[model samples]
Target: MEFFSQSLAEALSMILSMDQKLYAIIWLSLYVSFFATLFAAILGVPAGFGLAVASFKGKRAVITLVNTLLALPTVVIGLFAYAFLSRSGSLGFLGWLYTPKAIIIGQVILILPWVISLTLTAVSRIDLRYRRTALTLGATAFFASLAVLREARFGILAAVIAAFGRAIAEIGIAMMLGGNIKGFTRTMTTAMALEHNKGEFVLAVALGLVLLLVSLGMNILLQLAQGRYGERV
Candidate 1:
């Protein structure tokens, strides 16, 4: 109990002092995760929308694969990305290994499936009557798709929030791909692991607190969005 109390106090002091390295890690984490989520959203939203509106051969298989990917091991992703980014690999010319870009790439891969699957669910839940009515009113396919998307905007927001949350909390890809280098590729999760491994509980605890706060904020946003769109859903 005494040791734990001492550790907590130290953690609080470190956070209050505004440690530069800590702040750097936090910033890098946010930056990479933001871009990763953006990349995922860009690719996932359109793909999900297309999947929802179009029926074709192998659609079920694709969705199933995406669902399976949601649970993909981070280490596996790290290995796959590392292979391509490493020397002698196909993308080695880009030299992305052990960098923030590498972390972002891995995170984007991790979140893409979630975003696509969740957005697909959101789009699928939209009433077909809306699309039919839009068509009956002579709306073009593009406009009809837009109207359906607007109607399901809240659910899509939820999906995005979920993807962001997942990306922010992940450690394996960030550590393996980013190399957990201080003031560079280090993220909150990777920092926490490094600190803990070094028997430095203060920074680890502080980063953990930040991670918790981030998770809480995302959940709150999700709830508010759901509340606003409950009737529409």
Candidate 2:
């Protein structure tokens, strides 16, 4: 108990004092996660929107595949990325292994399915009237789809928030791809693991607190957005 208390106090102090290493780790984690989320959003949103609106052969199979990918383990993604990025791998000429780019690649793979699946669900739930109404009013097919998307904005936002949470919290991709290089690729999760392994608890504890706060903040935002969406509906 005494050891725990002492470690907690030090951890709090490290956070309050604005420790540079701690901040650096936090920044890298957010940096990697933000880009991963952004890239995933850019591709996933359109793919999901199209999946929801378009009718075609094999559509159900495609959605089933995407849904299956949602449960893909992070380490699997890391290993998959590692193969292509490694020295002897096909794309090894790029020398991206053990870098932020590598981690971002793995993280994007981790969250893309989440964004796509959730966004598809959100858009699928929208009333058919929205698209029909827009089209009847002479809106182009593209514009009509946009109109429907606007109505499902809140759900999409929730999907994005959830993807960001997943990206920031994952450890396997960060550790395997980034190699936990300090001041470069070391992220919150990787740093925490390293600190704990070294029998140092202060930084790890501090990162845990920050991670919890980030997750809490995201959930609060999701709830608020959902509540507002309910009211709007």
Candidate 3:
């Protein structure tokens, strides 16, 4: 009990002091996760829309592959990325290994399937009549898709928020590919792991608190957005 109390006090102090290194780690985590989610959304949203609306051979197979990738281990992604980014690898000329960019790349891969799968689910759940109505109105294919998306916007936003949450909380890819460098690649999860391994409980606990707060804030925002727009869909 005494040890717990002491550690809590120390953690509070660290958070109150606004440690510069800790802020850097937090900022990097947010930046990388944002870009990763953004990239995933760009590709995933269109792919998901096509999957929901278009007919083609092997579409089921494609969806099955995406579902399988949704469960892919982050460490596997890290290893795959490392192989391509390492000095002797084919794409080594890019020199991204052990960098924040490398971490973002890995995270994007990890979350892309989630975004696609969830977006597809959202689009699929929309009423088929909605699409037909738009088509009957002489809407172009692009406009029809846009109308469908707007109707299902809340669910699609939820999918994106979920992907962002997953990317930000992930540690395996960040640690393995980013090398957990103090000022550069270190994220909240990675920093917590490093600090705990070094027997530095305060920073770890403080970071954990910050991570919790971030997650809570995201959830609140998601709920608010859903409440405001969910019924319109």
Candidate 4:
């Protein structure tokens, strides 16, 4: 009990003192997750939007594929990434394995489905009247989509925030793709795992706190967005 209390105090000190190492790991975590979310949004949002609005064959199959990907385990994703990024693997000439870029790639792949699925749902729920009204005003289908997207912006933002939360807290992909290299690819989740394995609790506790705070903040935003939009997420 005494040791737990003392260690907790020490962990608080680590956070209060602005520990450079701790902050650096947090920054790296944020950097990787941020870019991962950006890439996912860039690709997923449009793909989702198109799927929601366009009349195309095989669309249901594509949506099912994206939904299925969301169920993939993080380690499975890490392994798949390794196969592509490993030196002996095809396209390995890019040398992305065990790097922050690799971590970003894995995280993007990990969360892309979440973003796409949610965004597609959001856009799909918008009343067709909006699209018809826009068309009646001589707006193109693409521009009409922009209006529907605007109307559903809150739900889409929530999806993005949710993706960021998932990416920031993931460990398996970061560990395998990033190698948890200190001062580089190391992120909060990976660092916490490493520290715990070494029987060092303070840094791990601190990182866990940060991860919790991030998750809390994201959930709060999501709730607010959902409440305002009155949409199911």
lDDT of each: 0.90, 0.93, 0.90, 0.91
Candidate 4 stretches greater than 4 Å from native: 231-233
**Which parts of model 1 are misplaced by more than 4 Å?**
none
Count of clashing residue pairs in every prediction: 0, 0, 0, 0
TM for every model, in the order presented, reads: 0.96, 0.97, 0.95, 0.96
lDDT of 4 at 192: 91
Stretches of candidate 2 above 4 Å error? none
Task: Report the alpha-carbon TM-score of model 3 versus the true structure.
Answer: 0.95
- What CA root-mean-square deviation does each model show from the true structure? 1.1, 1.0, 1.4, 1.7
Per-residue lDDT over 1-233 for candidate 2, one digit per residue giving the tens place of the 0 to 100 score: 99999999999999999999999999999999999999999999999998998899999999999999999999999999999999999989999999999999999999999999989988888987889888998999989988888999998998999999999999999999999999999999999999999999999999999999999999999888778766656
Q: Cα RMSD (Å) between model 3 and the true structure? A: 1.4
Taking all chains together, the TM-score of candidate 4 against the true structure is: 0.96
Model 1 lDDT per residue over 16-92, tens place: 89988778888898999999999999999999988988989999999999999999999999999998999888999
Best to worst by TM-score, what's the order?
A: 2, 1, 4, 3
